[model samples]
Target: MACQSSLALGLLLLVSCVSWSSATDYTVGDSSGWATSVDYTTWTSGKTFNTGDTLTFNYGSGAHTVDEVSSSDYSSCSASNALSSDSSGTTKTTLKTSGTHYFICGIASHCSNGMKLSVTVAAAASPSTPSSPTTPSTSPGTTTPSTSPPATTTPTATTPSGSMSIGSVRDLAVIGLGGLMGFVLGVF
Candidate 1:
């Protein structure tokens, strides 16, 4: 019974750790909300957007329209061929791919008045697997020496988008705890 309980706890921990990686929801225009005269560029500056993240546009109903458009259309402030348009005052768009995404207000003269947003989305970072250490081997009668220097790895920093990041220290700790629990369950 104790073994079963420990196994269950371990499984729960693993599941929770897996669930920690989730998409982020960014509210456009922040406290100012989505409207004209707001510097969308400034709002996007210093913010890191990743694929699977969502952009929520909040505005007064019927006053403005959230229109997703191509780069050319966005440059011209034209929504005649919008990829998607929403006038519900609460537009939610999930970034499905990594690249530049353009948005603008469909209302007349609103986009030209700086009500447009263009954000570059980066691909979501994949969880890195821990690698096993390699052991150097030598022949029984001969010695082999490596000519090249040992390979080194450089770790890149990733900015977390709201939810817990994959492969983060917390994630590693949870994984380690789960593994320990599993080992204890096996022993019992």
Candidate 2:
């Protein structure tokens, strides 16, 4: 009985950790896909990208090339000295650093027509020790209200379109295995 309980707890922990660490996969341009005529600047707005996240560019195989370039190349729509280039219709780039990354379409006139994208990735949040709560100091028998209003912020949500990422598939596989293990252990 104790063995089964421990197994269950271990399975729970595994599932939770997998879910928490699963990185997001953003489909560039959403439904419009990686192409000209799409406003990439607006597409990237309001989205908080983090390291470990992936950006998938979907386009016609021969129609366009996904080129990873420096800021100067992106600004000038130059693919002559691209850091990386792919014309395989689909390109998947994993953000490994915490800084801005730029991409542009290598096809002539494509990038100038707004087929360039620059995304700023933030470092992934890590687990930290909780800070102790502080109580406001007040004078004896004196109640003072805060002079300033509380600050509020709006969170942006992004949904991946068209396909599921490899990470998502792996997460599901882990969860399924955990369930199977639990079932077999229960029978034993």
**RMSD to truth, every model:** 5.4, 8.0
Deviating ranges (above 4 Å) for candidate 1: 1-6, 126-149, 160-164, 169-174, 181-187
Which pairs, if any, clash in model 2? none
Worst 10 residues of 1 by lDDT: 158-167
Q: Clashes in candidate 1: how many?
A: 0
Q: Please give me the total number of clashing residue pairs in predicted model 2.
A: 0
Q: Per-residue CA lDDT of candidate 1, range 1-188, in tens? A: 87778777777876676666457799999988899968999999998888889999999999999999999999999999999999998999999999999999999999999999999999766656555557678879987875555565646565556644455757586767867766985786
lDDT of 2 by residue, 35-125 (tens): 8979999999988888888999999998999999999998899999998999998999999999899999988899999999999998755
Candidate 2 achieves a global lDDT of 0.83
lDDT of 2 at 173: 68
> Model 2: how far is 3 from its true place, Å?
6.0
lDDT of 1: 0.85
Candidate 2's TM-score reads 0.63
Each model's C-alpha lDDT? 0.85, 0.83
TM-score of 1: 0.77
